[model samples]
Target: MEPAMACHADRTAPVFQTKGLTKTYRQGDVEVHALRGVDISLYPGELVVMLGASGSGKSTLLNILGGLDVPTTGEVRYQDIDLAGASDRELTRYRRDYVGFVFQFYNLIPSLTARENVIAVTEIARDPMAPEEALDMVGLASRLDHFPAQLSGGEQQRVAIARAISKRPRVLLCDEPTGALDSATGILVLAALERANRETGTTTVIITHNASIANMADRVITLSDGVISGEHRNSERQDPNTLSW
Candidate 1:
C-alpha cells in the first residue's frame, strides 16, 4: 500500500519507503537477483506482514530496511535518512538508534539471564524501557533470572522480543519470529509481538512464509520472484491465539 493510505489517520510520512529497490549478488558465473525493483511504503504504527515463499526476497528487503544491507540500485528512505546512499558508519548508527530486529533464532547470550539479555541492548540505547517493563510486556515477569539454557524455546524467543522492544525503537523488524516453534508455542510468540506492537505503537514488519499469519496484520503484502505481487488491507486484525498454522 502507498504511504498515503496509512491505517492511522495521524501518520502522514511513511517510516520506510523504497523505490526501484534491487539487490543482486554474483555467485560464481551466475547473477542471483534477490530483489527486483521493489517499491513499498511502510507507515508508522502499522503492523505489516510480508508473505513469500523461500527465496522470494522478503529477507533481503528486511535486511536492507534494517540497515544490515543496502540496495544495489534504488532509493530506500527511513523517514528523511537515505538508506540506499548511507555509509557503513551511518548505517550502523541508524540500526542502533532507530531499528530493532528479531530473527528466527534467539541469539541470547547463554550466560545472561532474561533481564540481563534485555539490559544488554537497553544500556546502549539512547532512551530505553526498564528491563522489567519489557519482560512484563511479553508476560515474562517471573522469568527474569532464567538463563537461555533454562528457558524453553518459546520462552527464549520471548526474551529476545523483550530485548528488541526494550530499546524503544521506532521500527521493529522480525524475520520469521515464530518459524522455530510449534503451532501453540508460535501463537504465544505472535501474541507477544502483537502486544508489543499494540502497546508500544512501533511500526512493525513481520516477514514469514506462513500464509495463516497474515490474518493478524493490518496490511499484508505478498512477494513473488523478488517483486511485490499482491497487497491488501485487513479490516480488523485477528487475535494470535485464534491463529493456527
Candidate 2:
C-alpha cells in the first residue's frame, strides 16, 4: 500500500476504507467521471470535513459511502463488509444497520410532530434510543409536540439531527447540512452534529463548501476535479461552541 493510503502506524482497522474508488456516469458518447482512483481510510470516532468546490465529487463520494449509490469501479469497506461487492439486499441492510444521513434541507414530515418524526426512524431500527431522548440530545426536548412549520430553521435542523441519530448509526454522513440556514443558525446545527459525534462516538463525515466549518473537524479532505487535492490532519479540534462561521 502507498504511504498516503496507509493508516497511521498506531491506528487500528479503519471504520471505512476506499481503494481505487471510481464512479463514472455515461451520457450517450460522453462520460463524466465523478470520482477517480480515490484511496482513503477513516477511523472510528473521528469527525472529518470534506472541502470542495462545485463538481469536485464531494457529494458523489458521500453518496457512495452512505450506500445511496454504488461506484462504477473500486471498493468500499465498512468494517468487515465490502460495500462495493454487496448485493442490493445487503446494501439495503447495511444502510439500515450502520449509516445515517443528513442533508441541507430538513425532510421532516409536515404533519408529524417533532417526536413523531424521530420515532419514525426508531421504529425501523434494530436497537434505537427513545425518540424523546434523541430529541433532547439535539436540544429539542421542549419542542417535541411542535410540527415542522412551527419550528424555526435551526430547530427543524435539530429535529432532523434527532431523526438521524435516533438509531445510533455507527457512521453519520452530512451533506451541506447548513447550506440553507443563516450563519448563526448553521452554527447551532453544526453543534448538534458535533455533540452527536462526541457523545455517541459515531464517526462523522461532513461535506461542505464553507471553509469556516473545517476548524471543528479532526481532519479535512479537499477534493478538486474528482480527486483528492489535499489532506490535512488537525492536531486539535476546537469545541463547536468556539467555532466561527
Candidate 3:
C-alpha cells in the first residue's frame, strides 16, 4: 500500500483528522468515486457542521471518520492511532471506546423506555454516565419512562442522542440528525448535540443540507462533488433556542 496521505499529516495531534482521504467503488466495469482527496482536522470540543448535497460524499466521510468504514486510499487518525491502517479488531475497539454516532432515524426499540435505551449502551461502556444522568442532559428527565411510541419525533431523537453520548465518547458523529423532524423539532435535537459537545468537550461533527443548522457550529465545512469547497469559522456559536426557521 502507498504511504498515508499528507494533507493534514504535519498538523499537531487533533481530536480527529483525515489526510487526503479517498474512497472508490467498482460498479460492474465502471468505478464510482465516493470521496476525493478530503482533508480535515477536528479539534476537541468544537462543533462542526458539514454541508453538502446528495452524492457529495458527506456520509462517506462521516462513515470513515466514525470507523464504520475504511477509506480506499488515505490516512485517518484519532489522536495518535492511525485509523486507515488499523486492523478490523483495532477499528472495532476504536469505535467502541472513542466514537459515538447518532443517525437520522431515532432507531429506538418500540418496547424500551427512554432510560432503558440509554442504559443498554451504558452497560457495555467502560466508563459511562448514569442513564438518568444522560436523560437529564437532554432535558428528558420527565420523559424517561416513555417508550419510543409514546414520544414525539424530537423526543425520540433526544433519546438516541443520550444513548450515543452516555459513554462519554471522545468524538460524536451525527449524520442528518434532524432530517426526519420538522424545523421546530429539529432544533431541539440540535440543542442536545450542542449541549453534549459543550458539556463533555467531545469533538462533534454534524452532516446536513440545512443551511439554518450551520449557525450552531463553531465551524462550517462545505463539501461538493466529493471535495471541500469552503470552510467557515464562526465567531460565536448560536444558541439553539435563539435559532429560527
Candidate 4:
C-alpha cells in the first residue's frame, strides 16, 4: 500500500467541506445511523474515490454533498454556501447549478435519443455545453441518434454521464457508476469520467466498493461503519484502461 500523501490542497480553498456531519434515519422501531461525524474536504479539480462496502454510509455522504439530503447535525459547506442549512429551494438551485450526479444504473429515457437525453439536462442548466459536445466527450458522438434500447449498456451509461456533465457543474458525483457493468465495460465508463475531470477540471468524486477503482483517483478515502477508516493520496493516477477487477 502507498503511504498517505500529505495535504497539498492548503494553497487552494476546498470546494466542499464538512465538519461533524451526522445523519440518522428512523425505522419502524430503531434509529439507524447513516453517518457518524464525518469531516473532510474536497479540493477543486481533484479526483477522489471513496471505498466502502454496502451500508458503509458512502451513499449517505454523497447524497448530502449533492444536496439531495441534509445532515442531521454539523456543517456542510460548498464554498461559501451552507449546504446543511440551505432551504429546500436553495438546495434545489445548488444541485441544479453546481452539482452533477451519475448513478450505477443508466436512467436514460427509453423514448429519447442519446443526444436528446443529454439535451434534456442542458436545456435546464444555467450555462451548458452543447448536447453534442457533452455526448462527444464520452465517446458517444456516433451514437447520438440512437435511443437507449439501440445502444449497449455501456453506451447508455455514457449517455447518462453526458447528461450529468452537460450542465458544466463544478462538482461531479458518481455513485457506483460502474456497478452494473462487466470489467471491460466498466473500464470504458471510468475512462470517460477521467476524461471529463481532466478536460473540464470538474471536482469529481466516485463512491464504490471496488478497491481497484481507487488507483485512478488522486485520493482514496475508506469508510467503515459510518466513519472514515483511512485516507491516502496517490502519487500519480493510473490510466483507467490499465485497471482490471
Question: Model 3, range 1-245, lDDT digits (tens) per residue?
Answer: 21211111122357887889999989999988989999999887788899999999999999999898999998899889898999999999999999999999988988899999998899999999999999999999999999999999999999999999999998899999999999899989988888888778788899998988888788899999899999998766778766767
Which candidate order results from sorting by TM-score in descending order? Answer: 1, 4, 2, 3
168: Cα error in model 3, Å: 0.4
TM-score of candidate 2 on Cα atoms, chains taken together: 0.94
Candidate 3 TM-score over all chains jointly: 0.93
Off by over 4 Å in 1: 1-11
The CA-based lDDT of model 3 is what?
0.88
Worst 10 residues of 2 by lDDT: 1-10
Residue 40 deviation, candidate 4, in Å? Answer: 0.2
Candidate 1 lDDT by residue in tens digits, 71-96: 88999999999999999999999999
Clashes of 3: 0
Candidate 2 Cα lDDT to native:
0.90
Which RMSD does model 1 reach against the true structure? 3.8
Q: Write the per-residue lDDT of candidate 4 for residues 1-245, one digit (tens) a residue.
A: 44332323222899999999999999989999999999999999899999999999999999999999999999999999999999999999999999999999998889999999998999899999999999999999899999999999999999999999999999999999999999999999999999998889899999999999998889999999899999998877888888889
TM-score of each: 0.96, 0.94, 0.93, 0.96
Candidate that beats the other on TM-score, 1 or 2, i.e. the better one: 1
lDDT of each: 0.93, 0.90, 0.88, 0.93
